[model samples]
Target: MLTMNDLKIDTVIVLDGEPFVVQTTQHVQMGRGGAILRTKLKNLISGNVLEKTFKSGDKIELAELSRTKANFLYKEGVNFHFMDNQSFEQFILSQDQIGEISNYVKDESDVEILNFKERPLAVNLPPKVDLKVTSAPPGVRGNTARGNVTKPAVLETGHTVQVPLFVEVGDLVRINTETGEYVERA
Candidate 1:
């Protein structure tokens, strides 16, 4: 249990049976009353933002969050599937939960999954991932009139990213997962 005074940014807590990550916290003292804490929280699974205020001494359950290594299995319609490496347990997450990680993850790749109370909530990807270029358009020479020198290339995961004109099909590249940008050839 955690009291209002313990609330801080990045703290994970359970309210009304839902897990939330604290985005911001402020201790405000009303001129004539005890201090109150105003907090901005983000739903870890649903990606919702909520504003909540906790009066002094209010207590909340600290969420039980865990991360496990899982290998990407496949995607069906709106759901993505993974298998735990250790336990070999299978799990599914909707597209909403997969979110941006879909851009960098590929079939059979190992990723980290965040579980809330032992249930899968979200997928956490590394800062960089190596992917083989599936297709890249031939670079046109002397076409710098518009000053755009990069061309779109498709990766093994089917994610499209811009690569320098020199990059071509079959090249393995390291990409920044967060920004979906090309980092360098791996």
Candidate 2:
């Protein structure tokens, strides 16, 4: 069993037989008293979010979760496909579950898929990914009058990031998937 102290962002807990991932948590104490936890959680099954409060020292059960290595195959219609590395079995998830995570990955990328009770719950993206700029406007030459400047650039995966003005179309850039920010030129 886990307690309020074990709660943290991304922690999964079981409540009323439903699995919820903690989205946010704040701890507060009324002087000389026990603390309370305020948390925002998202249901892993139905994709709903709600705020929950827990008293200090409260015990909660942890959900049974699993992760497996998978390779993104491709998206067909509204479904995204993956193939397990060990079992070679295929899995498909809809856009609803995939959500904004689609922005961080492209075809053939390796990823970890989190599952609950044999169902895919979420996708864990890598820390960094290399992407090629598909469209980048030309930087004004002799426009060195400005300090560091960035221009919008679209990646091959269809995600856009602001790149240094010197970046050009076809340039390969590294991006931090977690932050969706440009890290450096690859």
The top-ranked prediction according to lDDT is 1
Angstrom error of the Cα, residue 33, model 1: value is 5.7
lDDT scores of the candidates, listed in order:
0.91, 0.88
Task: Candidate 1: give the clashing pairs.
Answer: none
Please give the lDDT score at residue 47 for candidate 2: 85
How displaced is residue 72 in candidate 2, in Å? 1.0
Note the residue pairs that clash in candidate 2: none
Model 2: per-residue Cα lDDT over 1-186, one tens digit each: 998999989889998888899999999886988899999999987889999989886898899999998999999987899999989999898776778778877899899999988778788887888889999889886565776488899998888898888899999899997788999999
lDDT of 2 at 175: 91
